[model samples]
Target: MQFLDTINFSVPLLANATETVDSSMVIKSVLLSLVVIYFVSKLGGELSNKVGLPPVLGELLGGVVIGISILHLLVFPEGSTDSSSSLIMNFLQTTAGLTPEATPQVFAAQSEVISVLAELGVIILLFEIGLESNLKELMAVGIQASVVAVVGVVVPFGAGTIGLMTLFGISAVPAIFAGAALTATSIGITSKVLSEIGKLNSKEGQIILGAAVIDDILGIIVLAVVASLAKDGEVDINKVIYLIVSATGFLLGAIVLGNIFNQTFVAIADKLKTRGGLVIPAFIFAFIMAYLAAVIQLEAILGAFAAGLVLEETDKRKELQRQVIPIADMLVPIFFVTVGAKTDLGVLNPTIPSNREGLIMATFLIAVAIIGKVVTGLTVFGQPGINRLAIGIGMIPRGEVGLVFAGVGAASGALSKPLGAAIVMMVILTTFLAPPLLRFVFPDETTTATLEAASGTSLVIESDVITLTDSQENELKS
Candidate 1:
């Protein structure tokens, strides 16, 4: 028998060995990834605090520094072939071993394990986001938030599309992809900013938080629409409508179901008097709801958000939050770092920039990115003493949401390399710009605290303004 035939015939033997080898490698990869994420997050958190910056910025910078491309270059000199051998072999061996005829099944097994772990990272990130959310506060400002979110999404999308079409001479598909990229508002960084400045519960902060929730919902809808359009050469209005309806229904249903379940689960936990007994059930419910949302063409994060909202009415909510947060705190940074790692700076090295037409297109898209959300700040109606400027600055950061759009666009081939590069740059700039501008606009504790008081909100000061430590902020729920 041929060697290939022999290998294929020995599949059962290989499978058993592969499982053992894979289990070990997976453990090693997860441990290594965790260690890297821990040290990077710690260092980033320290640098951000030292410089009066959001810790997320530090985390992202660390990710970029240690990204595959950058690290590859550093570990292997420019003209060296030594590093290529293992890298190529790893990729090929992993791909080949997935089939029946292969010597090393360990590579494929490691890949599967890493993929599962990465997915877990996503789930935990969403859960943390949900836990941090305050549904009552969000509801209070829902109308204003809706208006701001709409304007923020629509204006940038329109501007981005038109700019791309008119100047870059791109088609509607790619233009729409660019527009979709502009719709997300990264609230994690904004939340950190508000916490750092002790204004997380103020009227402006409430508006920002509310608007950001809506922003994420709308952003996902836009992405779904753009993706559908790219595939069929026409927008699937029916799919879009179904997505909206399903998302709305899923959120409402999860809220009602979660409230009912949370009460029952908490009662059981109380009867048992066991620590964290309720968490497993809560997590299971969240995963189930998230799965249902995915089935209906909605993002799982939306369902996770609903799950958090539903748990708000439970008696054991604080205990639940406390128990789950530490796990989330450790795992959430992996999601952010993975996002930064996907960014390829090499896309910026383009030969067409000197083309006047390309330059004009890029300029227009940049303007759209800047102006769209800035205008949304005016949507805070019926409120005086509101710093619309700060609200706009808070809305500026595009962090994870933009990255999601860019990733989808790249996968669908709707975003060209140069355009993707520009979008990434735009996201990074907006994120970095918010904190300093916010500090400038709302300078002191007196002003921020007074604003909070006027809004009938409470402010918790956990640390020095100019010097923040790595401690978590005291949540100021209304």
Candidate 2:
């Protein structure tokens, strides 16, 4: 009788312990995934640099190697792999003694954490871009940029919509959504490439940056309008007006607040009496700005960008920029890797019968995607000597913005499989090709640097912070 009682008590304890262990699996999976990400990012980045391409491309390809299409090691829910399908989950099951019953729940929790990290990575990226940018120059080119943005949106959107409707016999709503996807200029991808090539401060770069910002604002409004049409078959005028007003108000308010907050921001940074004083205060402001943008139904990255712009005007811009770089380098690869990992290249294969039709449809999208944004450079009337080709090439990538549209259309049942696959193909090609194409269109600055360096003009690594050369600094002051 005593033995029976002991067994009953132990049974309950065992059940409790199982529950505890199951919950802890999420942490284990997350830890393992980070290890994989870091390894892939480092390997990819190094290889890319060796090939004279951007390190980001290498990081992205590394993710693809480890992700669903190749190794199936780092899969996500959006990529259509659940715990049962994930190699990581299988590894945990065999190695870590993870029970099949608890696997799905753990996998979900782990994926959420990674996704959040990736989102934060992008927010930080946009903030870094804004900090590197000259706000006054962005403002100076505002009129020209707006024209470029408007022209960029109208051309691709109109052309894509009309072509899809006429050629493919697609419905109005789906065509409109597809057209909307064409209008996105991934500021993240474009800005990163510009920074990598050391053209982020150029005249074309400023206009491209300015136009990209306006493009995002307009894209949001267009997305809302199209999404509504998909759902209800009619546009909500009130919602459209609200989006316009709120987006415009948020940007204007951020700029106004930047001017007002600079003095106070400096005061707070000065009073901090510990390590990370400067960067911590700066991030606090950035997070607050990000939160505000999200609260107003705007992109969090926008607020982070606005915060950076505000702080860029401060006395500590150079120090702040340097401080932020290490943090950025650490987190930014996660964003790029995840993007590559999430990409499913299987649909692009012409070996599959269904994929062949999609490939044909994709041709149209690919053409429209390239031609639409390339024309925006011609819209710049006053900026003589601007590299028009470079400016337009800078706007080519659709990146995650395109994915959002494809996902929404698929979710809403507005797009057919062929059309959706075509859209994805367009996004993948543009995103992957833009960096190389952008590098191509711009002048070979590296050769110029080499020639200059060989002509008894030595370059110096002043510090971890990027110090402009004396000539470059003089030009900036002038």
Among all candidates shown, the one with the greatest lDDT: 2
TM-score of 1: 0.77
List model 2 lDDT by residue over 146-235, tens digit each: 999999999999999999999989989999999999998888888888888778878899999989988988888898899899999999
Residue pairs whose backbone atoms clash in candidate 2: none
Window of ten residues with lowest summed lDDT in model 2: 1-10
In model 2, which regions exceed 4 Å deviation? 1-21, 446-478
Score residue 164 of candidate 2 by CA lDDT. 92
lDDT of 1 by residue, 255-314 (tens): 568647766866776776466577877788778776776667666666665676677567
Question: Which candidate number has the best TM-score?
Answer: 2
- Residue 135, candidate 2: Cα error in Å is 0.5
The parts of candidate 1 lying over 4 Å away from their true place are 1-21, 72-119, 187-189, 192-199, 258-262, 349-363, 431-478
